[model samples]
Target: MPNYIALDWEQDQLFGIEADVNSGAVRLKRAFNLKWPDDVGTDPSARGQWLGTQLQEHRISASQALVTLPREDAVVRHLELPPCPADELSELVRFQAAIKSTRPIDELLLDYLPVEIADDEVAQSVLMTTVAREQSDSIRQTLESAGLTLASIGLTPVAAAELVVRVEEQQRLDETETSLVVWAHGDRVEISVIKRRSLLFTHSTRLTSTEDTSQHIQTILAEVSRSFVALQKLLPDVSIARGWIIAPNEEAETLAARLQERLSISTVSIPEISVRTIDPLNLSGSATVPIDVPGSHAPYVGPAGILMWASGGRAEFVDFLNPRRPAEVKDTRKLRAIVIAASVAVIIGGGLFWRQSEVAALEKAYLDAKSEQSSLEELQERAAGNVENVTAVQEWVDNRVDWLAKSHDLFNDMNGTERYYLTDLRMTLAGGSGAGNITGNGESKTYGEVITLYQDLGEHPERVVNTHEIPRGKDAEYPFRFELDINLQKPEPIEEPARDDAEDTKTETEEE
Candidate 1:
């Protein structure tokens, strides 16, 4: 048999149970109040740590679970939606929740179910409800960390109403009429109106004192009156038959009697609805009251109702299941296609780059081969003209050498004759031009002959050198020694034939 567990938290206690759905049987395996330190709420790890200890202490199993939100922080509103297709129901619920809840739509956990379908096909109505997102998330996190899967999250009134309806159905009681079920536990009161096994309205209010009980009853009666008025307005033709009250103890009956006496409505007290009990010891005392009224038995009502709902009893309204959310399967398929397309593009691009590189290398090799062929043809053409160029160069060199030798001979011949005596001689040649120098002996008679010799050599630009010397000294045999250098001109470089021209000449010679 499938097992479902219900978990409920008290300010100082934790209550839980597991139930067999097929047999409508329940077993309460764990119940305890933890003495957590005052700083537990302020410390990040304290709550989880304490909860772990409690779970270990109670030997609670990790399985399917359900939790009820605390009454103080939650606002349970039973709302109606215009007739629409079931597929569009979630959006309608969300829109209604946004309008009714103080919290934004993003901060709410909403659920809905169809209460009654109108005879008209085009338009139908639905019952929708919402709870705080934080409330649902906190319960889910606490149970999931303990290795439990949260099956649902709901309000205490919702759960209690489920159990009440189940008991009513067992008795075969017709629920076509409006009925009020009040369960008063300590300072809190949970009240609900059920019509035809479906919840039409549920509300909770704090009852602080027995003296103020009348005021609280009046307040509840006013709320119930408003709900009936609204339902009548929506279904103006439908009629409310009657009302009933559920209490764990007679306190609810007493309150209901007083309200009936004042309002003149029929009210009855029902027997205590048996639920899975965690601690039979705790169940002792005044906790065993009628199922409709809450005394000390109020804490168990939430868990008991949750188990009843899990055990095949129809839920009056949906809790957390929504079939309208976008489909994850479709999203997965789209993402896979995108990744495949991107991979194919990358592979194709890589192949193109590789082919381009090969083409560039082949083009470079062709250009280099053409350049080398041109160079060979130019060299062949220069070789064909080599004989005439060499002959001209040799002739020029021979003429220059002969001229230089004759100049040297002329100088030696003059020295032998002693027309002028030379003391120092220097010469240098650069850039195909040259100069020389001579120092005259300290004889006034030889001075005129030296000047004449210098003039004659200076006239020949190829061998004549510029001359300079120190001034002549009286009584000195040689006045001064000379130092000089010659500046020479550079010969022009020979030109090579063009590649195209050399190729053409070779082709013509072959033809001849």
Candidate 2:
């Protein structure tokens, strides 16, 4: 199962679904919703963090996710061009879209799908889609922060168009037939025209909360009529024979009856949940939302349809964020020929050069080995001779500092005559370890003066490792008598490894 996450941005809520694209079937694993934040305007990271938490809670894991931007965030247009070269048609579409759009071309992310208008292979009709760069970039950055790459940035109406095609396919409708789809979402309604499996026209409008149900119905119908008229003018060759209403069952049935009476066309209400599902009750986040809802199941329809569109079930829409890069898709036929030709060349060249290089390398290595063998004894002698020199250098480097001078510097800063007096002092250096021990006794008139002698020695910790003091009972002047023990850091001894008998014999013979 190839699974993906689909995200939908609506006016009041953010909807997401995890589904598997198993061939033609799109199975919904879980669906989740998060309330749109009030601080979404100032702090954009709030949305990403919220979505990431929701995904974690639902355990929805996918490498990439598809997204549907709100209808108002994007611009969709159906463009028709006069006969021109296939390559130039895209440029023409861009020019037309730029002229009609209020924003500059560079300020928007644009893509298009060429709709097949006729079977004669000369028609140049296209569906041009554009979204504000800021809007697309904002959503893209948010998803990126959540560790999800935006595989496709689509629109609600475009997703609805895909659902319309899938619905027709499941119903086994004619391929050349045309139909009108009216999809009602929360606080918004989208009307689209799909002809021969290609989206022809799409329009979206905000639905106000009104007490009069009839007035609300009239507003939707009027918008539908307007869209229908516009579609006729745009594609005069095609006619929409039937219409489908996608909404809650009761509301859809009522709207369909009214729409049929007003437009004099057959209209039917399609179920809000259109896809074939293995389990309907286990559809919410963590498979917890019941199949039943208070009002209707209209909200789940849009998200499910968007998932179907992303899972290779629909083919008429273009993704702006992750559009197919024609340049990146190499012609495998030409690549295969080149690879084959290169293989033959490599085999021929390798067969000729391999044996020659191998023989030459082997001969060179043999000569180099023989030369190294001849110099081995000399190298060993030189290594043995350097050991004594290395040991001398190490001994001199470690004991270079004179401990007698360092100890002299320690007492030079002390005022023995005024502050304190040393009763007895002796310094001893341990054998070879280069460590010195100093034991001394000092007498002072007061205990404070006795502490001065200890402070003076502590000032030079580099020479005096540590010091201890013991006071003798006071007598007269210089009455406070203190005993001291001080240890001094010393130079480290040099260590040399034991020589083997063979090395000793070589050294002795060299000396001889």
Candidate 3:
């Protein structure tokens, strides 16, 4: 079951029903009739608050609502046009309405019933309905203030027509002929004509309030006659085989009896509510409201009619909120913008993917370089050990004394001797630094020659020490034997003396 709230906004009163349709029948769950507060007058806020309080007490929980605008609130037009394209019908109606309306067309909200056979079922006429945008917004705001959302909006006359047609279908009436429906509630009467389930004509007439039921009946009869004459002018050969009356059973029976006695309509009776079930005990929203205050079940016609429109009778009703419009135009600029946006998104996505791949490749390269660096570090450790060994050998070679030069100098000293010979000669490190000693033993023919050689070796900065000297046999070729230890020092680095250019020139002049 689908739930919806049906609201009928009448002058000084708000009639509502919370219902659900089961199978094809509308079951009234809760109903309310809130009168405008006498203290608040016409203040919308106070009215909304009072209505909300009443609803809360009644427990009307359906949030979405269908509203019925009183017939006077909308402008209705019936036009018979030359057959045109279905799509162009809307534009044609709009242009015609604009020409007729005193106000700008943009200020009005419009809805229409499409072309349908006239009351005669031969000619066709269109019903175009419009309401002021300000009126529609006011209704919307009023409902919103009462904690209700506006789902659809429609005129009371069209809704009443829909109700009567739907009730006719339920009663298994002959649908082949045109039907006329009369709905009287509050201070107005709604008269609608139908053919083949399509609404042909509907009119709302205000009545003066009177205590006499006969007077109401007489006034209704007069209006019914006038409506028929007017309908005849629109559809010359109109055929209305049956008629329906929706009102309280007493008033309905009286009016139907009177109509049957006077009019040519074959059958005129009250449309049955078997498809719509309402409990009188459940109708009142507030506990304080008396069950008998509503008097009869007839006043719920507006809500019930709109409910029918919301359910399945949509094609018969004109909804001002959601109306038939002209052919929709497509914007080429919007299409181009969409295409451009899609292209930009694709480019950005591709760029991001490329950047991600590039970053991944660079990271892999960095890891590979790190691995290669580890291997190079191991090779460097081996090379460093080899370099230290080579450096140690180079230091040894550099620090070693010049043994060949020492031996040649010693031999030159010996050549000065009468007889000279060396038994042993060795170079040993005298200190831990780059200095060593040359040790040798030699024999000379005379002691004087040996002494002279020692004196020659004992030059300043070069040390010569005589360890032992002995006389040899007289027959020996050398008479003296000597042991000598000589200390050889590493050469000191000498800094070049700066030349005196003036002194040199002076000396050159003196030499010249």
Best by lDDT: 3
CA lDDT, every model vs. true structure: 0.55, 0.68, 0.72
lDDT of 3 at 406: 76
Question: What would the per-residue lDDT of candidate 2 be over residues 139-225, giving only the tens digit for each residue?
Answer: 777787677887877776677666666656656777676677777754578887677777777788888887666777788898887
Model 2: C-alpha RMSD to truth?
Answer: 34.1
Better of 2 and 3 by lDDT: 3
TM-score of each candidate?
Answer: 0.50, 0.57, 0.58
Candidate 1 per-residue lDDT over residues 1-512, each given as its tens digit: 66666766555455565554454444444333345456666332456566666666767654777776545555555555566665576677678878877778888777765555233435445556666677666666666666677787766766766766665555566665445566665566666656666665556666556656566566656655654465556555444343445443434555556545533432221222221212111232212222232124445677766666665655574466432342243557778888889888888888888888888888888888889888988887887678678876775664343336644754664555544444544333323332223222323235555565556555544444455653555545544333332232233356886579778899999999
Candidate 3's residue-wise lDDT over 102-173, tens digit each? 889999998788645634444345888888998777777767888878899887677666665655555677
- lDDT value, residue 175 of candidate 2: 64
The C-alpha stretches of model 2 lying farther than 4 A from their native spots are 40-42, 58-63, 85-88, 98-100, 120-123, 265-295, 324-512
Q: Candidate 1 versus the native: TM-score?
A: 0.50
Ranked by lDDT, the better of candidates 1 and 2 is 2
Candidate 3 TM-score to native: 0.58
lDDT over C-alpha atoms for residue 283 of model 2: 28
Model 1 has an lDDT value of: 0.55
